[model samples]
Target chain A: MTSRGVRHDSMRARNLAVVLAAIHRSGPHTRAALAERTGLTKTTVSSLVADLLEAGAVTEGGAVRGGERGRPGVAVRLSGRRVAALGLEVNIDYLAACVVDLTRTVRLRRTVRADNRNSDPALVLTGLRDLVKETVAQAEAEGLRIAGGALAVPGTVEDGVLRNAPHLGWRDVRVADLVELPFAVDNEANLAALGELWFGCRDADFLYVSGEIGIGAGLVVAGEVFRGTFGLAGELGHVVVAGDGPACRCGGRGCLEVYAGQDALLGALPSVSELVDRLKAGDRQAMETCERAGRALGVALTSAVHLLDPGRIVLGGIYEPLFPWVAGPVAEVLEARLAPMRGAPPSVVVSRIGGDAAVLGAAGLVIQQVIAEPGRMLGL
Target chain B: MTSRGVRHDSMRARNLAVVLAAIHRSGPHTRAALAERTGLTKTTVSSLVADLLEAGAVTEGGAVRGGERGRPGVAVRLSGRRVAALGLEVNIDYLAACVVDLTRTVRLRRTVRADNRNSDPALVLTGLRDLVKETVAQAEAEGLRIAGGALAVPGTVEDGVLRNAPHLGWRDVRVADLVELPFAVDNEANLAALGELWFGCRDADFLYVSGEIGIGAGLVVAGEVFRGTFGLAGELGHVVVAGDGPACRCGGRGCLEVYAGQDALLGALPSVSELVDRLKAGDRQAMETCERAGRALGVALTSAVHLLDPGRIVLGGIYEPLFPWVAGPVAEVLEARLAPMRGAPPSVVVSRIGGDAAVLGAAGLVIQQVIAEPGRMLGL
Candidate 1:
């Protein structure tokens, strides 16, 4: 083929991806809306949509009757078939795998209990492979085919090596090789931020704090997770809150995690789920513990606010339910502490995705990779 | 002009600006180097440089001698003529102004002690205007022509309004109107981060925490200040370190600043500068205070590291002296807290700019704006 032909084909593919991404983000919109959103000409949008329709990547929904028009406007939506991606979220004590379709819907999911605190990379990989196999099989049964997958771990991963996974006790494990899929691995907190950016806030500057066995945060700026140079930007649990406080797993004392994370709470009380359940059931002790955690978290969030000035903060992970128990104390601490900006503090919210944030974010990584332009892929 | 002619002219102007920026950054490189750096043709660089020289915006230096010479290669450098930018730094008890040439050299400087604390917008503006005029006069005497200026303020500046300047005791002041110079204003910490990114670190991922009367941090991620959505970020001092510690100016108790900031130390011991001087003279009590401040600052830096994963933390302002005095304890705290990575903890360093960080950064903002696009009057 001629070089010009190759260039034209790449441009067409890029425009098609833009159209697909827009639809995936906004669900279904008219051709005019798609053109406007993607900044593509009508002719370009039409050509791309026609190609997608032929490839079964998108399908036409029936005409809408709302608008005043000489001709009815037809809606285009991502087809439920043809392409799908998988997400794997490996926590300290559990594993979650999900199959997501082109429309950004989870078609299949499976969760399994697994202890990854033994520092054995093999154990985590075994759990991951099993989870992926189970979820993919379920998706296959449901007639959803998976094209690729990505995993989210609560530690630093660089060049496919799991350099640190405090919760899993895994260090320097070859993540990509272990997963054995055309996949990418990212820090869990980073994914949580992306999860909220994609599905929760969509257009809000957000800080997503993933509180589990260890605590961490993800900063979403301008609708994207701000991953720092080394992929370890969200390790907030280790931020020293108490200078001479108790030593943390990361060796820092009086860190927010030492005060508010799952391990700290579990060490102080019974299992986290028990306390959370009791807190939800209005147990005074549980409520007080939640409040204390919230206060510590509030202090951290205040710092987060002072640093990034995000619009809102999204509390996610297993600790999200503690928002009600902790929000008041956190808000109180924030109001008392923050340089009052016109009498209001930044809003703090709970993650809408509940426990599915990391896995969904992992899935999003695949989608972003598949659709991103070469210029963006260069990591600039 | 015809529509096509106008469009062509706009493209030419943009390309010329690109060429100029490349030369300004890389400095005195051969035509090949400029073309390689800017992805422009050697012919384009030659043409644009000629135009710029003719316009008196640029001047060529002596010939670049040394490479296999058939026709001698000519070197180029900024003439430091045509226009000058002013930078104003507002300190708690003083104001500093500097005039920088297009070649990025400080041609003139003037500092005056002013009661900026508790000053109104008009007072601050008047002070800044007088300082600017003085500096402008100084620059003109030195044969430098003034063009525009930027002010560095220690508060959240939104639409030219100072939301709050606690040290200055100013609130909701229209800073832009007050300082009637063709200028822009931003948080001092952000500007410091920009300065460090541009001139100091250059390639280092660092956090610049301004430890003046209040505590603020500027995050440099991938060689740029990672300003959050509303441009308010890097507020490390407010991170609640002690839940029930001393009250802070921000109305919060037990903030990092309450333990580590200037006012906090002064309130605890009184005669802060005297104490610092005594410590320099090897007074044990004064050394203890500095050490305690370092510990608190270290705790805050831990949180920043967790959140940013910066390669280094550049402490600026009056905090510079504390680096050596506090480095041991801070490193101890960080080592105790950071995640067990294969490598050592991120390096913490004091900024080279010392007390002049804000003014240098303010000047840097204008330099960045002009250098980014030489043809533009200034950056917005």
Candidate 2:
């Protein structure tokens, strides 16, 4: 093609994305409305809609009506079925995968829980690869083409490389080669935050604390995940609370994880359920332990609140189930510690999506990529 | 004017800004170089440059060197003389104002030292107005026109409303009407961070801590100040240090301010200089007090470092002068507290500009706005 033709095609590609994004964000709209909203001519919008329809990124839905001077017309909606994305997670306790379509609807999911800590990366990745293969096979049966995928790991990730997963004892591991399709790797905490931003009711700026064997935090600022300079910003578990307390797994003394991590709270208990049962029975030791852990979590969050001034704080992982025992002490510390200028501390809430937040968020990231360039998805 | 004509003018106005910003960021550039840099056609760049020149936002200079084969051509530089911006600062102990040209060079400055604590807003503003008047007169004498200005207050500010200046005991003060020129108001710490970004050697992501009577922080992320959800972020002095140490003026107990604030560091010394002299004389009490403050500062910053992961930390205000005595303790605490994942802590440096940072940042902001839309500055 000539250079002019290439430029023309690129311009149309950008306009197609602009129209699709408007529909995804504001729901369905007629071609006339799309043109008005996107500041493009109706003829151009009609051509772009045709291209999108051919690419299976959009479909004609029921007639829409508007207040403006215009006749009711069929609406263009984001209901693509031919394209799908995969989401995978590698955590200390589980390996999971899911397939999601263009509408961000999960088509299939499988989670296998196991003790992944100190496990060999090759063995763990084999399980993850098998799970992804099942998800992709299910997508194929449903006539959904796998466009891309992403892996969410609990570690510091950069450029599809996992620098370290302290709980998993894995470092410098690359997961891109495990999947047949194109994929990205991201820190699970950041992905969890994105999940809250996409799937949960809590939108705006907030911090998502993902607690498991290891504690991690994700900062949602200005409606996006702020990963910081090294994509390692929200390591909340390492915030020094006791200042002279026990050393943590991450090799930091007096870290919040020293008190609030699973090992710290559970001690020799086999499972969190055991501690939950004791708390439910009003066991004094369990109650006191939870309260102490809560205060420690509170101390760490107090510093986080003052430094980031997050609009709200969402506790995930074990904190979600333990919110009853921990919220009070957390609130007490925040109320007493936050400066008067901040009138009242933000509410501490439980995770709505729980453990699946990261995987779902990973799928949504792929959906975002497809929506951003439907022309590319169609191989235009 | 016709609607099409209005759009055409607005497009030109935007293009004018594009050209000016290119010149400001890249220094002197020939029209051909600008066209290549901005991906605009040579004819378009020439037209935009002409508009900027007429707006007194750019000056042509002789420039003839290039790697690519081309004829020697005059280069356009950001060196406007007629249009200047004003910067004003209100602190606990002084009022300051400065006038700067389009090139961000300060042409004149004035500072008046006074006890502004608990002073009436009207009285303090009156003094500020007088100081601004002198600065404006000096600009006028130099044939410079004041296009706009901004005020930096040591408090939380939004939309020109000073919500509160904890150190000055002032609230809900408005300082706009005091200046005749178009102006804006912002938090001092945010401006000081901007000052460091524009004037100091440090660029990219860094946190600038402005320690006066209150220790406020300005988070520079992605090369801009991140003023949290309510534009009230960076209240560092109020970060809880000791869960139950001492009640602070801001109604928080065991806060960092209780240990690290200017009052806490100076104690009964009456001034920072007295404390500095005592420390110079090897006074044990002074050394111990500084050590405590440094540890507290380090603790609060550890949280900030984990939460924001700023690439660097700059200590301004009193910390600059007290660097010799405090840097060691601050570094020690940070080393003991930060996660081992972060191999080494970000270097803690002292502010190079010191007191002039905020005022100069305010001026630079005005200069930026004028450059952003030279057409608006010229009233086109």
Candidate 2, which segments miss by more than 4 Å at Cα?
A: A1-18, A30-51, A63-70, A113-115, A119-130, A176-182, A371-380, B1-22, B39-44, B62-70, B126-134, B145-147, B174-182, B370-380
What are the per-candidate TM-scores when only chain A is compared?
0.87, 0.91
lDDT of 2 by residue, A50-81 (tens): 98888788899765757466567789998757
Instruction: Identify the leading candidate in terms of lDDT.
Output: 2
True contacts kept of 2: 0.41
Across B1-380, the per-residue lDDT of candidate 2 in tens digits comes to 00111124555666677777777776899988888777678888887788777767778886655746556778888765888988899987889888888877888988899999888999989888888888888889998989998999988887789988877889898776777667889999999988887777457788999888888899887666887777877878776665556788766666788889998899888988889899999999999999999998887788778878888899988898898999889888777666366778888888889889999989877877887667787675
In angstroms, the error of model 1 at B68 is 5.6
- Per-candidate TM equals 0.83, 0.90
User: Could you give the interface RMSD of each candidate, to one decimal?
Assistant: 7.1, 6.5
Q: Can you list the residue pairs that collide in candidate 2?
A: none
- Taking chain A of model 2 alone, its TM-score versus the true chain A equals 0.91
